[model samples]
Target: MDLLEAIRKRRSVREYTGEPVDDAVLRELIEAAVQAPSAINQQPWTFVVIKDADRLAQISRKAKSHLLKASLSEPAHSFREMLNDPDFDIFYHAPALVVIAAADPTDWAVEDCALAAENLMLAAYAMDLGTCWIGFAQNWLATPEGKAELGIPATYAPIAPIVVGHPRRPPPPVPRKNPDILWIDAQTHCA
Candidate 1:
């Protein structure tokens, strides 16, 4: 699929069929992810793939509890209700999760990982797979226990927690509003 087409069609899929994504396919997605341009060619991203069902549920519960307790003091009021429900999985029951992490001191680490994540997500969409960046897992994943659970080093920061699997159904397209633009050509420049 064309890049623009994939960009337009790709959606943050929440529901999955519980089918495990193949290791080869996951490797292909990672290959695509690493192809993303990095500042100064640091290429500092690492991945942690989680396919264990029981572990996924366990982490889901822990992360949800952390978010609920956190929402009390923070401004995340909108997520409290959904986080309170035990059945509402943050992963949407996907069979695979690929986390993108970068070394703590790596310059432009967050931006680099985000670029890689976009590549992975677009590649998944083109390959008839689904992907979603699980923001709810970020904070917990940074904790020491969470890091140990995934075997990510304490010196690395988990920037993207993406779930991957066969989509249960194609998500409906969401409309986009016109972008606000500013023209600063010579003709439009202020005197």
Candidate 2:
């Protein structure tokens, strides 16, 4: 699929078939992520692929608490539910969990990591796999339990945890808003 097609068709998938993602396919996705551009070529990113069901659940449990408190409406609320749902755990039993981490130094590392994640999501969609960018886990991942469960070093920080698998439900294209919000000119809008 073309980049535009992938960008337009990609959706934040929550429901996934209980299918295992092949290592080769996962590698392809990660390669796309690594190909993303970084600030000043500081490609400070690391990925942790979690496959064990028990560990995935442990991480989810740690994250669920924060999700419950998040100020979100309907689908987002359902997102939290899906995370806690017995059937939803393991991200619908998708074979892999990828934790995105960046070196904790550069000021632009967050943006770099986010771009990498977006690339990964788009790549997964092109490959016909479902992907979800999980942010609620930040707090949980920072805790002792999370660190121990995910096996993170003291220096590395988790940027996001993405779930990947074959999508069970077909996601419709997300509507686009006006692009006028982007100002290309150098003229300042505010004094």
TM-score for each prediction? 0.95, 0.82
Q: Against the correct fold, how does model 1 do in TM-score?
A: 0.95
Number of the top TM-score candidate = 1
- Residue-level lDDT of model 2, residues 1-191, one tens digit each, is 89998887888887777778888888888999999999999998888898887877766665776566667677677676566565545344566888888866588888899999999999999888899887666767766677667777867778878999889887777778878776657675755
- The clash numbers for all candidates, in the given order, read 0, 0
Model 2 stretches astray by more than 4 angstroms: 66-92, 182-191
Model 1: per-residue Cα lDDT over 1-191, one tens digit each: 89899999999999999688999999999999999999999988999999998999999999999888774555678789899999989999999999999965577999999999999999999999999999999989989988998997888889999999999999999999999999788688575
Lowest lDDT 10-residue stretch of candidate 2: 84-93
| Whole-model Cα lDDT of every candidate shown, in order | 0.92, 0.79
Residue 49's lDDT in candidate 2: 91
| Cα error of candidate 1 at position 42, Å | 0.5
